[model samples]
Target: MTVPLVFAAVFMWAMWDPTETLEDLPVALVNNDIAAGTGADRLAAGDEVAQTLLDSGALKFDAVDSDTAKAGLAAGDYYFVVSIPSNFSTTLSGIGGKTTAPALISITYNDNNTLLASSIGDSVMTAIRAEVVKGTAGSSVKTVVAGLDELSSGIREAATGSGQLHDGTSELSAGASELAKGLQNELVPGTAEAADGGRQLADGTGQLASGLTDLRAGTDELGAGATELADGIESIVGGVDAKGIAAQLAALKRALPNDPSLRGVVDELTGVVDGLAQLSSGSREIANQLTDPNADYRSGVNELVAGSIELNDGANELSTGLGQLNTGAQEAATGAAQLADGANQLDAGAGELSAGLSDGARQAPELGDDVAQQSLADLLATPVDTKASNVAAAQFNGPGAAPLLLILLTALVPLIVFMCCKPLRASASQPRRMSLRTWLRRVAFVGGVSLLASAACTAIVWVALSPSPDPAELGKTLLMVAAATLMHTAVIAVMFAIGGYVVGAVTALAGIMLQMFTFGGVWMIETVPGLLKWLNPIMPMTYVREGFISSFNGSPGFWSALVIVVGIGVVATGVHLLLVRERAPHDEPLAAGSQPA
Candidate 1:
């Protein structure tokens, strides 16, 4: 019942639109003026505006009996009224119907309800005055005419609104039908397909994130080491000027058993004087190394990067080729299936041919029961026909996903195992762990192995796939892959070395979780909330994935991704080395996760 009343109220409001009530008022008809009087004529026009206002429901008015109205006005039962004088109607009928109607209505009102009273009195008087000017077309008539115009306009507006609503409804109806059609044609299946895609994207992103996190941790360490290196360089360069190269060298020789071959050999060997000279010479060497664009380590880094670019191209080509081959094989399988279908059809035709042969045999002269009759007919008889038989069975050959996964696993196992071993060299006992030199050798060896493995795998996959991507684009792709893979491996391996399998495993899992849920590369990133978007940068996959996309397309974004990748790699490698060097024997596997007391 409440609901019905609420609905009724809403309907009423809609029908009597407030604007209509306020802007135009409906008036009840009242013909009080004497028929022949000018006052009556003027009052007629006043009546019209009142009537129009009444009809619009814009305002409410009553043409009460004069006797009744006067009584109501005195008793305060009525707000106001238009009292037409006796000659009111006669004036409007005369020739000056043009400018005479506006001033004729004699108005009466209570002054107490000041505002309401003013509006009523003013409106009535205005209508009467307009009447003499435009016959009965006084202010009220003009207002009514305006209201009539509004009515027409309202009708047009209603039609426009209805049209829009009709279109909207039609669209909605079509959408509903299409929705049903989509359900029938694609929605259900597409949803399942999209779900599967989402799952895959999630998984891919997870892997990327884990890889990236490991890389980022590594980069942080590398950055720390770099800061230290830069500081040392500043100290060294401050120690000696470029001109003191020989004298510095000579002093360094006296302080050392060997020749002054530490940094600037012969140049630092000239005669020297002060105590600050030695420190200065040493500082100069450090500064020179830091400042020189062609320093050994920096040059090596550049070379490594260049090699990475080549590697990236190769990897991209491989991935692309592999993708194409997968597509082609699918097509080939379909073609083979079609061929098998054709062969089956041929076999069916052969069976029909065999049936035809049987029919022909029955009509053959000797085989038929008409031998005697055939003796006369034999002279005109034709030889029997025969057709070939079908003897082959249809077969289909194609690979499925499982076998491919297995093959992939088999190929990657060596690299994975190699990564596991390379990082453990630091902790090895005996001569291997005897000195800093030995440790350095181990680090270099492992780093070299990881790099070589990455390059070789990239090359193999690229060559095998033969993607035929543009060379430059292809190169960038391979570099991205190699950089990402090596960086991830180093970071993960470092974790394994520092905290054992558990720490590495946990980090890997966390990375995967973030990748699947937070980052948006595999799906619409913008769909995620602001909080997630903010968190996205923290995921290592964010950087690597972007780099991968950039590299894949040979887009301008390649450099940015490359920088991030390298940064992660450096940090990972540095942190791993530093942790291994400074590790305490009692540090637990869960140390990072554990809160200090």
Candidate 2:
């Protein structure tokens, strides 16, 4: 019993070998990436290749001492060793100013493991190098792109410079000819003309400098105007927090007279209040929008502020018009009250004018359209759009390339389960007595198994996350992990029902690898061969990984993918059961005691 238990434990551990760390591999890494970038966080681009290679579990490392590292290939231990050159990051300029860099990783391997080691090193190194190149492809491509742009600009400037030289030479020739002709006519006049020309040249420099100053000032003024507009918008938003509109509406209601017809008065007040509510809502939207502007250039904001100035100017005009009308109505009311001190007769005509003025005053609702324009201006003026998406991506993807723990957990658990249970085998009575109790038991069993899968997988996932990680970011990642675990269980459950442990485990593994290539988008999907590419949706891991990513990002794709993957798993399980039933072996029974007699 003790021997069997030991054997079983060892078997279980081997089947569920969870020791997936970079330290397990047999490769040597030396980081010598030295690139020029201003910021501390600016990618030391070359180390990325070495780091990725380390991430793959193919290589085992024996630390290279400084002496050996400098000398090139180290003494025995590693199958292959990588040495990155010191000038790995610096841009190269070949003869004729052609831009390219020579960032070579010299890989040397021992002769003992040459063929196998070379093959492994090559495959792993190829994948890592591809990613490093692709991830910073923007920088590389930008070098050429920017160089081309600069070259084009330089060429245009050179063309203009050539024109300037031609013009100056022509002027000089004409001036020289004139001077010679004048000298032939006589001396003092030509010399005096030369002095005048020198004075004009001096004036030309002064004028050119003045023109440049003017250009600078005009730009400064535009910038200042934009800043002022932005400041004004900030002030407005700060002044009118969410409480502002409600406060104002309450104040206005408080100010309204409580008439004999209370309902009429309340109704009248409510109408104005509704309009105010709308205006307030619109203002809030505008304020929110100002926090993130769409324009690439700050100058674009200037245009918006200029539009605001126009709008404010229009509002001032409207305000003035309202004031005049109010004044006129008061005068009319005063005249009517005095004329008819003894009667209500004057009230009617005064009321008529008052109504007209009130109606005119209510036109302030239209002010919102103009105010909304100001909001757009506010957004433009603020220049809040920041170009930091790459920074954000690096923050997330840089420190770690992937969740290897999850990858291993996903890879290993099914293997263990399948081996332990010896996978599913078809039987004759499988389809005969399908009942509600059977269905319920199967579901319960699947649920129990799923819970176990989640527990087992999540331990690995949480262990990986235990090391310091951005809390907010890791929270999202954990959510994705949880979702994926559930997804994996659902797939496992359904597959287990139809095909049992062995077949399900094998198929699931295949699906995961396929996803790693095609669906993980690890390699360029477009580069995948047409025949092989069709396998993407068929791969369960494709759905699992995409679903997880989408969930973390709050994408609808996650939910949609979840439904599809779960649904497929469930359907496939039933199909698997049907196939199993058909293939099941039946043992024919004979008379019970006949053999004994």
Candidate 3:
């Protein structure tokens, strides 16, 4: 009895605070990792992971060289060993650079240890991996955030430059528009007016040339009339000389009768001769003046003809020049208008582009601030957190597994007692009969004692724990425990009753061992191997644990466990009844039979 109690106590205690003792686990740490470079590249990921482990008190780090760690693991001195490669930090630092190989940390654990110990080591390694990833990713993210800030600054500068360009183009466009207005409103009209004046001047010059030509012809006719007048005067002078005026007058007075009429005629003739001579002299002077090249009339006429020809040529040249000037002015005006349009278009396009750049610059500060505040690693971090929550919290350090403990104790104690006190068999003597009632009564007594044991153990545990459980939960716990105890004792009794002492004890022990492994009373069944998980549903202890936890914590699976445990007991009892028979070849039924005959 004492041996069974001790066994159950120790087994339950071992799994009670499995996670709490992890800090005491022996792990050999070999930090061979080095920094990537000096100064800025001095990020060491492995060192950071090791420091975090030390700071958080997550593990008992036994710092040692690689050789010592490896030897210790081989000799079973250490449960597991962690080794960081020399290029670990370097590879991590070059993540986005040219490096392609993924950084790795090697975990060497002893396979000779128990499966539970190895599983614990695996969990620790997973934590270390998380720490390394967080540190490395955080460092790389800071650099990317810095680069974003610089890009934003460059965008702002570009916007400023574009704005200046727009201002300059706007001024150019205004100037060109003004020039076009001048051409249309002032210069074009002024040029047309000047051209009209040139046309008028040309007409005036044409009139002057014609008037001068008429003056030249009138001078030629005046000179010809003067010459004819001179010829007439000379003829008059010749006739006076032929008449010998004074002598002729004297002869005529002697030969005449001296009449008063004849005398008057002679006197008038004398006066006429004198006047003819004077007129002849005057006519000769006029002819000389008219024919002379130096005279005013001939010289004036020659100068007028030469001047008129010059004026005609000059007027034609002036008219031609004015026509060309008008054409040139029109071409210049058209060109100015085209230039103004082009400049205005250039200014408008530049202004719009500059506005877009300014808007971008305005937004750049907010974007940079947002990017600078957040680290890329924080956004992209992948963290693993393992939580071991107890649905039915343990009352004491080692009594949380009370349900499993009670089951094991009930089965073992009964089987051991059955083997030690071997009951006698019935003889084939006078009137032997099977007594099912007596067998049931004996099984009931053992079940009652098993219930008492389970209740007493739970009470003791409850008193020992800090902040004792509520009364409601305690009452439920007792009821679930009592049911488990009855089922366990009944099953064991049936096995012993059907299959004698040795066979029954061996079968009970084997079943208890399988239940310990399959029942998920310690670690989660999912984390265990597939074989153990597969056996979980079939094990009776699995239901016992589930029922106890459900009762205490208000979890599910209590009904299922109760039904399965009751079914198992009934099946065992039925099997015992069928197997039990009169194997002694009795001739008569026995009156009182404690065992099968």
Pick the lDDT winner: 3
Clashes of each: 66, 7, 7
Q: What TM-score would every model get versus the actual structure?
A: 0.26, 0.30, 0.38
Q: By descending TM-score, how would the candidates be arranged?
A: 3, 2, 1
* TM-score of candidate 2 on Cα atoms, chains taken together: 0.30
Clash total of candidate 2: 7
* Model 2 Cα RMSD, 1 decimal: 48.0
Query: Comparing 2 and 3 by lDDT, which wins?
Result: 3
Top model number, TM-score: 3
How does model 1 score by TM-score?
A: 0.26
Give the higher-TM-score candidate: 1 or 2. 2
Q: Report the Cα lDDT for residue 344, model 2.
A: 35
Ranked by lDDT, the better of candidates 1 and 2 is: 2
Per-candidate Cα RMSD to the true structure, in Å, reads: 67.2, 48.0, 15.5
**Per lDDT, what order, best first?**
3, 2, 1
* Error of model 3, residue 47, in angstroms: 35
Give the C-alpha miss distance for residue 396 in model 1, angstroms: 18
Off by over 4 Å in 1: 1-415, 418-435, 459-472, 502-506, 509-521, 527-533, 584-597
